[model samples]
Target: MFTKILIANRGEIACRVIKTARRMGVKTVAVYSDADAGAMHVAMADEAYHIGGAAAAESYLCYDKIIEVCKQSGAQAVHPGYGFLSENAAFCRALAENDITFIGPPVGAIEAMGSKSEAKKIMEKADVPLVPGYHGDEQSIEFMKNEADKMGYPVILKAAAGGGGKGMRIVWKAEEIEDAYEAAKREAIKGFGDDHMLVEKYLTKPRHVEIQVFADQHDNVVYLFERDCSVQRRHQKVFEEAPAPLMQNDLRARMGKAACNAARAIGYEGAGTVEFLLDEDGSFYFMEMNTRLQVEHPVTEMITGEDLVEWQLRVAAGQTLPQKQDDLSISGHAIEVRVYAEDPDNDFLPATGTLTHLRPPQESAHVRVDTGVREGDEVSIHYDPMISKLIVWADTREGALRHLRKALNEYQVVGLTTNIEFLATLAAHPAFVNFDVDTGFIAKHENDLFPKREHITDDALALACLDVFITRDEEAQAQADWSGDPFSPWHSTSGFRMNDDNHHELYFVEGDDIITVTCHYRDEGYVMELPGGDVLVRGERDDNGDLAADLGGRRMKATVVRHGDNLEILVHGRAHALKLFDPLAAAEGQDEVSGSLTSPMPGKVVSVLVEKDQEVKEGDSLMILEAMKMEHTIFAPMDGVVADIFFNAGDQLEEGVELLKLQGE
Candidate 1:
């Protein structure tokens, strides 16, 4: 085995490769951009080097810099971890020219499978099953439209050089074709620098199942079963699992063979994945082959008991295959959920901020976490927003699902918004539980998933009030007249009678209205019996005069203050700011609260679409903000005029920052 290898990537994949390299007694070198200077991957490697700027193009995509780093660090080989320069045939060729091993497929295979159009041609020639579509090099708009017309409506426009859902769009009608084509082309040029596209017939209910294939230089290849990546949003995979839930023995055997054949046909070596689109009719078609390790490879590793990165190094070192096709057997079911810094309720837009608190669940016999970030690291807008991959394995699919759900519940991230709630909902969905969903599941059930719920119970309100009252009573104890006021409710323990008759009114907000509850003290704490005959538990004040209470089975930390005849209790991160009103004063101080549009997260303003005083319609793109390497367009709240623009392009704004003011008339 090589003594040292340079990982020409960053994030969890880089850390992942280092882990296996270390296990094999090989030294690992990590390369990072300016943004990743203090990243977790850098800390995991034996040695680290700075490559270039923050953006991938200046750093991770700089093949020359990576090669130079490998030579400087005396790395015997370089591992491209699935993105950036992973599938670049020219980069692989250059590595070979430099006499440094590239731990991936040969250049010839990459060239054949890197481009979607060329991959289609190669698959067709190799007798692999293919979908009916136009894979020709016709770039004219009219030609694409005519091809789409022939393929029927509801076709997909894909960038010839695209992956990871970039430069792809689905058109459902002729009128949507031109706009989608233009958008796809523009994004393609920006993302991959390739405007060429291919039109394919859209499979309405397709399940994405990919087969893992490993090959060596001795023309030996073996398969590692399949992964079902059907859970997706915006064409991006959200969750994945190995040993597809509904897979049959015959189908698995046939798909495994086909995947190996495709790899062999391209003279493939090292770790690669052959992706397929399985339609509702049980027919599967070759999608494309990824020429490097995948983000969800942990699922395959858990089921097959194989370290694919180690296999890559061994194969690159010219080792023969260690096992034959007959020797491989899957052991269990493994499922992986990609934890990202994104908000599911906000159209799944990427979020950027410092991760003030991040605690992934500890790994156990059934759970593993692979992450490239720590608590203090900033989630920048220079790269993908994926923070980590949570993988769970069990003897059965249901067991794996249950394990994954429990792990997700224990996963904590405090600073930025995430899709944790969404993942929980997905796990609880009946279709997902029964494995009856497809790629379009999110789009079909978005309405049920996006709305935010505010579930306030009467028990919670009572608990909040009691918590605050205890805190205030503790503070008043130092000045209470407890010498001879036993019956006056101020002469018992802690300067307040434990068995007194005192009444206090608490006010809180529920939705748009305020609710007033009256509680009378009985024991050490208030014991107002609910009309439904349910009991409530309240806590005592701590040394700091703060009370903690269990309200409706939910814990609450509250601080209570009293002024004159009004009682104020702070709960759930809000200050309440309530006013104590006599029945006569309440009628005189009733007014409605107004609403305003605020920035949902921190990011940089990319473009301001509307000028001051401009009239805009609802759903119109008011401004575009770039965050976490993705652009999000903020829309108008309602039909209104732009009263003021508080921010312009290049302005750095914080979450809840007022970006604009609207006037409704």
Candidate 2:
């Protein structure tokens, strides 16, 4: 094994590689940009080095810098954990020229399979099945449209060099092809820097299944199993599962064989995944090949009882296959859901903020959380917004789903929005529970997946009031303890009642609505008039700060965190963010302003579609904010004239910063 290896990636995958390297008695050197100076991966490595600027192009994608760092740190090899320079064949070649081993496939194989268009040709030549489409090299718009017409309507245009579903557009009609073609080309050039594309017959309700294949220096190859990743949104997978649901013995054998053959065809080495689109009739067509470790590899690890990173390290070290095809076998069902710092209700836009509080689900042998961020860490706008991968294992699929739901419920995060609730709802959906899913599952069951907004319950309000009342005492006690006076008189004011009839009122702000709750102290506890009806509550903070409440004789427990005026409560697998209302501030009121379009999150303004005094209708695009590598458009709220413009095309703005203003008539 190499004494030290340089990880050419960031976020959770970097941390993941560091962990395995440490276990194998290998030292790790982490390379970070300015944005990741204090990142978890940097803190976990044995030694760290600063590469370049925060942007990927200046740092992670700069292969020369990475190779130089490897030389300086005496790293014998480089592990390109998915994305950035992972699949760039030129990077592999550069590493080879520098006499440093690339812990992935050789340059020849990567170049052969790097382009989706080229990969399809190779797969077809090797007798592997392929979908009926055009993989030609013509970049002319007319040629693409003609190919789409030949393939029939509902054709999908995909970037020749794309992966993870970016730069893809599905066209359902001929009239839509022109606009879709331009849009797809723009995105492809912006994302992959390759305007070349291919047209394919888009399957209406196919499942996205992939086979994980491994190869070694001795020409040995093995396919671990299959994973179904059909639950997707905007063409990207939200979750994945191993040993595909409803997979039969014959189908598994056939797909596994094809996967190994595909890997061997390209003389591929190390760990790679071969993706395919499985039709409803059980027929499968090859997609593209990922030439590095995947984000969803943990599900395969959980079921096969193997560490893929460990295997990658051994294979790169010129070791033979760890086990043969006959020796490998699946044990149980495993599922993985990507926990991202995104708002599911807001079109799944990336959310950036400091993690005021963070707590992953309690993990055991059967449950795992792979993350790189912790409390007080910032989810920067310069990279992907994914926080962690939650993996669960069980003897059966149903049990795994149940455990995943429970784990999501137990997960805690504050100070920013996340998709935990959406994931929990997805795991509980009947179609998902029954294993009846496809690429369109989320769209088909949109009503069930994106639930209606929920209101603050009366019980939650009562608990919040009680939490605030007791938290003051806790703070006082801590201050007294710090001063070496644990028996301070201020601690005795909690629950202090001059008489049984004493009463007090507290206010809470739920959005724009102010809720007033009157608490009347009594010998037994307290009775308060709340929304819907009157309820009695007796609650107190435990040693761990969890709120233990007895509401109307029913006991409940919750974890709470407060930041500024915001109070976050977690109870019964649900989260609620509320604010403490200040009536005095309301009395000193400020005027309400409208007609201003501000950024919902911190990001760079990619485009300004409207100009000053320009007439626009409702729903028109005003500008686009690019954050976390995703673009979110700001729309005009109503028909109006652009009154002013504050920022230009490439100015970085903070959250809630006004980008433009409009005057509506």
Candidate 3:
């Protein structure tokens, strides 16, 4: 076994590799960019090195810097955890040139699977099932359009050299093919430096199931069953599970053999995944192969009782196959959800800010959290905005899903928006519970997933009010301590009355409306007067921030997390956001700013499609901005003529910066 190996990546995957390496008694080295100076992975490594600037291009993608670190640290091997240089064939060759082992599939395997066009050719020769589409070398827009026309409507364009939902587009009509082609090409070049693309027939309601295959230097390959990655948004997997639900044993064996065939056909080594698009008719077509550890490998690990990273290390070290195909068996169901600091309602746009509060579900045999951040850490816009991967395992799929929902309920983060509630809703969806999964699950069930929340019940309102009272009393006690006057009435907010019961009003804003709840202290508790009815409530906050209380003699528990002026109260698996409403501020109204279009998030202007004084209809594209590695086109809000354009192509912009002005006709 190697004494040491360096992880040439950052964030969760990097930290994940280090933990397994540590368990195997191998010292690990970690590399970090300026943005990740205090990142969790760096602090966990036995040795760390500064790579470059905050951006990935200046740091993680710099092949020479990573190679230099390997030599400086005297590491025997380097693990390029998915993304970054993981699939870079040239980088693998460079490590071989320097006598440092690259703990992944050989350069031959990576190069074979690097280009979707070329990989399809290899699969065709191996007799692997492929979708009916064009996978060729022609790079012309007209050629792609012609091919798409022949393949019929609803063709999906994918970058030949990229994955992870980048450089991909689905066109439902011939007229939409050209714009999608150009956009996909631009994003492909930005992501993989390769504009080469392939067109595939988009299947309706197809489930994305992939087999985890492993091989070694001895040419021994074995399939580790499969993971269903059908739950997706923006063509990216949101939820992944192993031993895919509703899969038959015969189908599993066939897919497993097909995945193994693809691996062996390339003379593959190390960990790799062969993805397939399972159609409604039980026919499966080949999707591209990922020649590195997948982001959702934990699900596979949980079901098979295997450490894939450790297996990768062993395979790279010239060890024999750990076990044959027969020895490995799926024992239980596993599920993983990618918790991102992004808005699910707003096209999943990535959000950047400090994590004021990061409290995830407690990890046990049934639950796990894979992350590389801590409380107060900043979620930067320079890289993937993933918060963590929440994984759960159980004896059955239903039980695993139940655990998933429970874990999501306990998970909490503040200071920025997240997809936690969105995930919880997805977990409990009827379609999902009944195994109605597909690549278009989110789009298919939009209304149920993003439902408009109803107003809080009397109990929730009472809890919110109870929390307010608890906070005020704590503040009063602290003030009394500072003043050295325990009996000071001025510091108290009790609404004390000698003759009558103390009465108080608490105002809170949910969404855009203000709510007023009146309360009267009586009988050692409080009676809250709501629009619906009166309710008696008594609650106290526990050390763990849970509200243990009674609402009209009904006992319940909930968590109210406060950050700045916002309060996120989770009640009965539903999260509600409430802000303290100040009536005085509302009375002094301020004029709203208008007449200009502003940037939604910090990004660089990719293009300006409109000119000054140019007439535009509502929903016309005024400009496009690239941020968090995705392009967002700013559209006209109304029929107008462009009066002024503020930013130009390639110019950096902060959030809320006015991009262009439009004077209505």
Flag clash pairs in model 2. none
Residue 356 error, candidate 1, Å: 2.1
In angstroms, what RMSD does candidate 1 have relative to the true structure?
6.2
- Report the number of the highest-TM-score candidate: 3
Off by over 4 Å in 1: 456-665
Q: What is the C-alpha lDDT of each candidate?
A: 0.82, 0.89, 0.91
Backbone clash numbers for all candidates listed: 0, 0, 0
Give me the candidate number with maximum lDDT: 3
What's the TM-score of every candidate structure? 0.82, 0.96, 0.97
**lDDT, candidate 2, 384-503, per-residue tens:** 889999999999998898889989989998878899999999999988899889999988999988978788888788888778767765777778888887886655534556655577
Q: In model 2, which runs have C-alpha deviations exceeding 4 angstroms?
A: 475-500, 590-592
In candidate 1, what are the lDDT values of residues 1-665, reduced to their tens digit?
A: 89999999998999899999999999999999999999999999999999999978899999999989988999999999988899999999999999999999999999999799999988888888998899888799899999999989899999989888877899999999997897678667877788899999999999999999999999899999999999998778999999988899999998988999899889999999999999888889999899888999999999988888888889999998777889889998999999898878777877878776566778998999998899889887678888899999999999999998888876766556678768877887888889888899888877665655654445545655665565466545644644434344543333333476566666654555566676665554565444344445567666645566765466766555455543444443322334444554554565422424677777788778899889888888888775543456688878888888888888987777888888875
Model 3 lDDT tens row, 1-665? 99999999999999999999999999999999999999999999999999999999999999899999999999999999999899999999999999999999999999999999899999988888999988888879899889989989899999999798889999999999998999998888888889899998999889999999999999799999999999998889999999899999999999989999999889999999999999999999899899999999999999999999999999999998889988999998999999999888888888889998788899999999999899999998898999899999999999999899999988888778799989999999999999988899898899999997688766677888888888888988998999998887788776888887799888999877889998997756788998789988888888887899988879999888787667877787666789877787767766555678888887799999988989999999889899866788899999989999999999998777889989988
lDDT of 2 at 15: 95
